[model samples]
Target: MEESKEREKEACQELPSRRDMISNLPDSLISQMLSCLPTKEAVRTSVLSTRWKTLWLLVPSLRLASHDFPDYNSFVSFLDKSLDLYREENSCLHLELVIRKDYDDDQCCVTRWIDHVARHKVKHLDVECILVKREFLEAVPLSLYLCESLLYLRLHRVLLVGSESISLPRLKTMRLEQNVYPHEAFLQFFISSCPVLEDLSIVRKDDDNVKVLRVHSQTVTSLTLGFEPGDGHMLYHYFDREILGICIDSPRLKYLNFNDDVSKCQILSSFISSSVKVHLGGVRYMSYYSGGVVFSNQQVARSFFRCISRVKDLVISETIMKLIYFCMKVEPLPQFCDLSYLEAKVCLVDVEMLPALLESCPNLNSIVLDLTRPTIITEQITAWAVPQCLLLSLEFVEIKCCCKAELVGMKLAKYFAENSVFLKKLVLRWRGYVLEEDSVLRDLLELSWRSSTCQIEVYGPLKRPVRV
Candidate 1:
């Protein structure tokens, strides 16, 4: 009888009704969902629910890509309608353009739209042009660069003519993707122009005709450097395009991300200023680059970190962590390093190099270790590689991924109980695969350790989530 009742309950359990679900969703939630879709499709949602009637108007983000338009005139007409429709006084605007046009119609439309938006004073703008032919792009005036409300701007795959002519005064995030131009001349023009730019990213385009790519920027806080695949013939060309230009001169830069495909390129800061901090993701790679480049995962990590030669607060991917451990155990390292707050995602910590790297961080404050999806065996943690003083200045410790908390997890618990004098909080995030109720409870309870000083928080069924 009980089994039958359980089956009935299970049968009754279904996803919330679509009407009920739509009715219950808040305006903000609806707007956010609509924002991700194409602008036209997003606008069509007004008839879905009366509650969402005004939601599209309130959607702060507007993403209109030109690729889907039937013709240039259609794109221009839609742009005019959208600008007239979306009337938020203070909302972020995300404008991405992919114009593959040989005609002057789309070019004129783009400029008119940019001028219209600038007059409205949009908060955030990200502009992208996909292979915009030379003639049309050259005609765009410098007025787009003068907008004060633009917090973000991204230009991609466009012919950079009068490189010095483009400038943004209040840009917080700027991304230049897949652009090829003469190296030093390229940056001398751009860097000297943008006065208040903070976060900047430069990605080279895929072409052999381009010989050099030079980069120089001042007052940029966050930077991302990425590379596109180059034709083999261009590799031996007269101009040494092998050197990737990365100039992060911003005094307030706190985070950095790097990606490269050409293994031979020497990454040089055509010029670097002193005020940089927080290097994030020292190495980044494209799927094609991974196949062609000789840079081992370790070598890639090494190059990435070396670029951000300045500062603290770092976030590392699991792939990068694996490489860093390999390189750190190798022969040489500069004496006193400053990386203190490090966040890593990995199942197993490299025991050998972990201690040495920690030693470099004398004034380390916190360590956030996020476990990858596959559960790392508790016994495999290189706890001993962790220096004794690692937990001394550390105030917060977090551990994740436990099917059933075992040896390595226990070692971590004991380490905290014994060594952490100032340890205030310990967070354990639970994994989701374990199915049975009893087994889940047992696995969850297994982490509750024999500790007194630190306050422990388990992430599974018993307590609040580790994440806020």
Candidate 2:
């Protein structure tokens, strides 16, 4: 009988302890743990136990998405109650609200929520409203512009009406994507208000109603500007408007990604650093069907190239390459004296211009060529002049074949293999299926290399290296 009693006791003791380990933590620690979760999920934890019921009220951060709730009223009610509880308990440091449904009926409520957060000394704020109807974009409250404690701010698809009281002194990073700005002067004023801004990204839509956008900041270090055009058929409408101009006067800028096709004239201040890394892609001035290049585009391309000529690293898109080809036809391409790394997408028809392009980058040490949209190779490949970098500084070359038939890519690879004297490594990435893999490998192996120590590697469609 005693043995049976002891066995029962042992089994009872061994049963998983019902004592909640997480609940024993202090209220501060529990609130911090809950801060990382969305407000809806954090509130759900209240049902776990009585101890967690009021713990979520002390969380210092709130992340709420409107789609998480079944109805709009429920989302608004939860957000209002949470913010009220937070105000009574603690200050919120971070707040992110993503509204995916239409909020036209409750636009005032949206503005009220933003004003409330701004009053609570919120440091980091991210608001994204994805409205299917373009006409019903929610307007951002003017009070948000006066948020003195803001350190980071990101807004998407919001209407921003400028106010003279704008001041975000502590804000360091700001991203305004697809937002409606009243005017270019308002944007410049808004940017000027952020005295310590460091990183800025502006993604413009087709009809944002702003032209000649000027980004003039002394403290900005990184800037990304892109234009998102509508469908192909609607591009003609956008092109009918006046050509846009972008003037950048940031002295401390180090990185710039300019991918806007809408802007033809780009002007940079003389204070731009020579060591800036630039990526020029998706910039074209010619019509899709027309074979003729615009004269204004040629001039703009030359001026743009001159602005970024001192950059150390450059990435060119296929459209930009065509623009360069046209620019070269008028005058020789500008010399990029400090350029060391280059990545470009070249069509098969423009393969002959690759050498001329490299000649402009005399100090280039590495190059990546993406051969896309391959056409038939008709003429002999004897038009290219030997570039200075091939004999001196060029060391690494990577060629990517994006089509099934890689005849042009193979010929270009052979040309590089026979020309680059100081080449260290050559990587050929065949992204298309090959019927005969062995023959492809044998053909690459038979190519004559100018450098005795050059190592050649071929990657098949599966991205695996092929060895003899």
Candidate 3:
């Protein structure tokens, strides 16, 4: 039996091994395999064979995260060893470092790591730091600003202290969130430094010192500006009521999201802009109850809508709905020839602007109206003529409201059912505020359908299923 086992083992060793097939792959492909793994796991592959021993060093991408290490000291040691070994052989195309600044040594290590990557020709760089102390004065190394090879960059919670001059020649996309700047000029200087930046996002925190934000990028296509307040309940305490102004002048800008509640907006240029699919004037739960923002009679929102009049797709929120309602009475809104889809909230006080708003969008196709609360339409409907969109372009209609308010909900539903010539589908969902009979479904089915192929579907309150 021993001789038989020995013979079988010898036979298996003599046969060609399957592991040799993977080992025979090209060095470039093997390095790519190591690139997809975490730095620690990639280094562990060294025990596989001698061919993979130096394969990790040639990886074009490196991501070192401190959370994967046991302690801050170990994390620093790993970065020192890995970056040194990687620098000797080849340069990296992408380098991402997610570090936490808990100790004083962490800032020094991060500075050195930034210096190392700048010299190694990193094309894409991202640094995310969680500052343990809010008042930590660690500034990003000035060497990072001079990295001409960067194509994409994103920084979060990193401070840019006094180093005003920035010259990133090849950068295209950049995002700075919770990053501290000395003043508004520093922010503008950092933005204007990138000549070829196409997509940019700036999120301002409560600690930022800038009062007025001015964007004058000629090449930016997508831009988002948001403000984070310090306190949730008390808006006047943390937010400056001085009416923050946002001046924009990007001719090539296509997508813009100005979702700040505490600021006033101003557009400098009359450039054609693309659409944004967002809830325009919605606030957080705490902000809603606090009643800190009031745009009902403000001209700031009017200017904002006038600038984005050429938008192809629009979504109006409750606050913006009120603004449009009030603004329509004073001045005529810009003709929204580019608008194709609109989602709006129809309330009691703002129903008068519905017809006027629909008239502005000559090319609108679909509309969704939320009639959840009881809207007291005290004034009679004045306009009897249907809009041009309802006759030619409008197709899909969806309405959501309470079942008890069927009288008011069906008024809009009957209008759509009788008017929409090209209507494709109409969906109505009714939830009950109190126990009431769901006669809406039966009544809607009996309405006169304008389109030949319009399908009507209704969903009532869901009933519990009984188990046998």
Question: What Cα-based lDDT does every candidate model obtain?
Answer: 0.56, 0.79, 0.71
Model 2, total clashes: 0
- Residue pairs clashing in model 2 are none
lDDT string for model 2 (204-306, tens) is 8756767777888999999988876532426566555456778888888998887865236467444446778888777453443244634446676687788
- Predicted candidate 1 versus true structure: per-residue lDDT over 1-468, tens digit per residue: 999999887766744463457658677786677777777787787787676666777766667767678876777687777777766573436666666564655446655666666666665665666555444453233566567777777766544444445646777777777654445564556655677777677776546134445444556666776665543424334123344434434445555565543233444442322234343443343222334433343454455456644456666666556555556655443322455566766545442345565665655667776655444444533344545445457667776654543334435545544555666677665555343334433543454333345565656544444322
Q: Write the per-residue lDDT of candidate 3 for residues 1-468, one digit (tens) a residue.
A: 999999999888966665567778898888878878887888988888887787788787778888888987888888788877776448866889888755764545656777788877788888887653446545678888888989998887767766656889999999887777888888877888889999998887666677777777788888877766532325655433445667677778767665566224454444646544434643432222246444343466566677777787776666667656656776777788888888887675566567788888878888988764575674454344688899989998887775565556667778888888999988776676442234655676677878888877666566321111
The worst-scoring run of ten residues by lDDT in candidate 3 lies at 281-290
Least accurate 10 contiguous residues by lDDT in model 1: 270-279
- What RMSD does model 2 have? 3.6
The best candidate in terms of lDDT: 2
Clashes of 3: 0
| Stretches of candidate 3 exceeding 4 Å from the true structure | 1-17, 103-106, 131-134, 162-165, 230-241, 262-288, 291-297, 317-338, 344-363, 368-393, 398-415, 422-445, 453-468
> How many clashing residue pairs appear in each of the predictions shown?
12, 0, 0
Clashes of 1: 12
**Predicted candidate 1, C-alpha RMSD:** 10.6
Candidate 2 residues lying further than 4 Å off, grouped into runs, are: 1-19, 103-106, 132-135, 206-209, 229-233, 262-265, 268-271, 283-286, 289-296, 374-379, 403-405, 435-442, 466-468
lDDT over C-alpha atoms for residue 177 of model 1: 71
